[model samples]
Target: MAVSAIATPVAASSGSFLISPNVGLMLWTLILFGISMFVLWKLAFPRISEALDRRQRAIEESIDAAERTREESRELLEEYRERLREARSQAEEIIERARRTAEVHERDTQAEAQARREQLMEQTRREIATETRRAIDEIRREVADLTVMATEKVTRKTLTEEDQRRLVEEALGELDFSALAPAREE
Candidate 1:
């Protein structure tokens, strides 16, 4: 009986419509699938597409902002480099000006020192000339007095002023006084 029952169920299942192709069921399944697709297209598809579009726009805006920021950074970097170059040029110019000023100051100082040295040398020469003249005059007076005294002693008579003047003139004319003067430098 159990064998018969199992054989009967297997035979019935083998002839069942579920295992065989049925045009009615296929048509009904197709109709249900189309209805479900139409419902999703009308309700879920628009919301999903709108969300995707919003995401795409947000991504594009972020990219645009990043690009703008990169361009601004590039501009700022260029500006900084330009400013640095200007600063270096200004620094070099300042150094050059200072160098020129220092050179001028050095030259002026040397020239001033040279002028002072020349002035002092001229003053010393003048003083030496004045002293030499005074010494020579003193020597001349002494010699004149000595000559008068010797003349009076030798002649055994007092010489008059005229005789003394004549003798002194003759003695002064015989002496060479040029050697007493200082030699000129140039």
Candidate 2:
């Protein structure tokens, strides 16, 4: 009935933006639309929807893989940073240890030098003392010999061994031996 109403043209012209449909034409158009809808539902629509679903899943999986890769890269970066920090700290510790070792070596070297200097000084002092004793003994011998010669000249006779020994003893007794020797600290 609606198709018949649209197909019947009005004798009076109305100011409306409408076109009348022909009855036979509207009936054939409906038949063609139904056939096309049936064919698409049976074959084309199912394949198109399946393809769209597969494409959507593929896109989602790609996004997930990208996210995983980004997370792994972040973890690697943090690990590398930690290793760098450790290496720097270890280097600092090694440098500090080397400095401490150098300090110890310097102190040991200085102490050893000082000890060697003291030992050398002591040895020199001992050598001087020995030389002084030898010089003093030589001088005493010379004085004793001169005194014996003078006594023999004065008496106008050669002095015997006994007389020479007695004269040397008297001269040695008169002198202070302690005063000629070096003073000891201890």
Q: Give the alpha carbon lDDT tens digit for every residue of 110-129 in model 2.
A: 99999999999999998989
Number of the predicted model whose TM-score against the real structure is largest: 2
TM-score of 1: 0.62
- Please report the candidate that would top lDDT against the real structure: 1
* Candidate 1 wrong stretches, greater than 4 Å: 1-41, 144-171
lDDT of 2: 0.87
Residue-wise C-alpha lDDT for candidate 1, range 139-158, written one tens digit per residue: 89988988888888899999
At residue 99, what lDDT does model 2 achieve? Answer: 100
> Candidate 1 — what's its lDDT?
0.89
Candidate 1, residue 148: the lDDT equals: 89
Q: After TM-score superposition, what is the CA distance of residue 171 in candidate 1 from its true location, in Å?
A: 4.2
